[model samples]
Target: MSATKQHPFYKSLTVAVLLVWTAAVLYPLVWTLFGSLKDNQQFMLGKPWALPKFPLLWSNFSYVWETYGFSGYFLNSAIVAGASTLLSVLLAATTAYILARFAFKGSGTLLNLYLSAMMIPMILGLIPLFFLLNEMHLINKLVGLIIVYTASALPFGIFVLVGFFKTLPRELEEASAIDGAGYNRTFFTVMLPLAKSGLVSVGIMNALNIWNEYIMGTVFINDPSKYTLPVGIAIMQSEMQYRTEWGPLFAGLLLSMIPVIAVYVLFQRQIADGVTAGAVK
Candidate 1:
């Protein structure tokens, strides 16, 4: 509230800093977007920082989709990421609910186990998980990727939901019990709805994680036909054909980015509210 605190210089400096950060973050996306509108030769030879030539070539995206088999990759990623998010959120919510609802033996131990799992590097489990999936005949399949993503994401999801659930009042449970509702009914009808923000938060995070995952796809999948978007894009980058197709490659990058941006935009409010609510309660 002081004169110095409300100085125009301070306001100007803060605006300048934020503008710089925004440009730093958005420059790549803008570069990629404009580059995607040019022909490969023009894109590669021309100035990268400049605008694309007019009569914009939209064929790059189509080429990436049809000529490079990106459509299948997109579909595969959606299936894997979507299924993993659903399973991870549901299982994590149930587990967190149990831990938060009542005092039980070894509850602290169980919670610590989950938290400890988060600290373990996923790299350490890669070989064992590969062999385990191979034994179960889940290798080279999206289902196997789904299972892995779901399991790996569970610890984080449970940690977030536990915070939300612990903050809920005991009166909600007491009221449910008074209505003669069983545990399952009360949880699904009352407690679950109350945790909507937390669930959405975990769900969005897990979806983004699985969608963007490359290592899991690389370790498990062998068939090019079965490749998820990340794996497919990696393979494309490695291939000689895409070496000259810079425009299409940028087009592919933009395509891969769209779903992620959409998800964030759609659930952004929920994510903000959930994190804030957890902190406040």
Candidate 2:
């Protein structure tokens, strides 16, 4: 039996599967949104799928802000993620340019080394990293967190950028050179602009990763004031476990997600272009 006509049942089954998948994905976000508006009692007593009546959205948000010290955590997270992403992208761009454009002795070996580093699990490095950071007296500091985030992101960022840069036309560089543009000028004025989409994509990914990271932040930053969103939320959860205050927790979760979602939405076009270009090239 030749496909479509004979597989009418299969088509119906596929449609049903897709509907279920869509509901599965969307239900949690809808539930969380509703839950954020409910008090601790209502959240537990009401149906999981029910919408809130007289939604206490503002109260819940206010509670989260005060109870979790969310303002401080938000600022700390923004600083660390932003600094790390900026540093990583700049360093990645330079390193990627060298790897992609230059043909030096043992270039392949060096590239392979970078690739190999990616395979090593970050957890394995934590103990030694912590000890080293302690020696530098960087423990419990935002700078140390930024440094760790930058280092952790560098390998994958460089790998992605290297591929993107390699796909760029060499003719552009040669044309710039003929016009008396130096390497720095050509890279900054020509290549970087052309590669803006890729840089944005990499930077956004690094920002999200750093912002959500809990393990390293928890271990390295003992001060509550220095805690990022993830760690602060975790602390809130632990403290409120007996009472189980769902309202503030849900509100906090929603707040934590806003920046990441906003970034993806704002740069949606650039992210799409970057992925498409990277794939095509």
Candidate 3:
């Protein structure tokens, strides 16, 4: 068979696969968007895939925001995730730099210890962690959540950043050192700027994870005002007894996803470049 003839079949196959994948990914989001515009009558009587005949868009969003306390939850989520991302990335960058650049007798063992931490399931540590937090009087607080999130995200961040830092040319640091630059100055001005893409990628991933975290948020935070979006949304679902407010619930769900999607879209290029750069070396 000619190359051109085979290419068309391969192209057709790729298109078909992509279409199916897109549908699978978008169906729930589309359904949720339409559902958020539907009233109870439409939700109960009509197909989920169908658009609402009478759009209650503003009403659904208003109800969710006003009644469900989504604003507070959203704010809490943002604070926790943002603080955690900042702290985790800073710590990871410093730690990864040391691990990547320095050679010590126990360096390999230390790296193994960090990797081992990743293998331990979070659930297994939940009980002890809860007790520890309680003893420290950090329960039901944003700071506590930030602490947990930073700790949880640190291992992966360090691993990824170490790999990225290792790929950086040693000559740059040597050149800086010869010009009277100290370790801190060289790292801050030279390595950090070069590693911006990788740091951003790690931060975005950590932020997304923390923002949508449920189990830790639920267990640690009992205060309604301190609840993150995921826990708050779940609470909203549970509060509905006689009839579910599908419209408002879906509206809240859609609204909650906005930040995550926006962050990904905004930093997508950096994330892509970071991953590619890391992989190349």
TM-score winner: 1
At residue 91, candidate 3 shows an lDDT of: 95
Runs in model 2 lying further than 4 Å from the true structure: 1-16, 44-49, 55-57
Clashes of 2: 0
Residues 118-236, candidate 2, lDDT per residue (tens digit)?
89988899999999999999999999989998998888777778878898899999999999999999999999888787898888888888988999999899999999999999999
- Candidate 1 structure quality by residue, lDDT tens digits, 19-57: 999999889999999989987667556576678988898
List pairs with backbone clashes in candidate 3: none
The TM-score measured for candidate 2 stands at 0.90
List the candidates' TM-scores in order. Answer: 0.95, 0.90, 0.94
- Minimum summed lDDT over a 10-residue window in model 1 is located at 40-49
| Alpha-carbon shift of residue 57 in model 3 (angstroms) | 3.0
How does candidate 2 score on lDDT? 0.87
Candidate 1 vs 3: which has more TM-score = 1
Backbone steric clashes in candidate 1, count: 0
What does each candidate score in C-alpha RMSD? Answer: 1.6, 2.7, 2.1
Which lDDT values do the candidates have, in the order given?
0.90, 0.87, 0.88
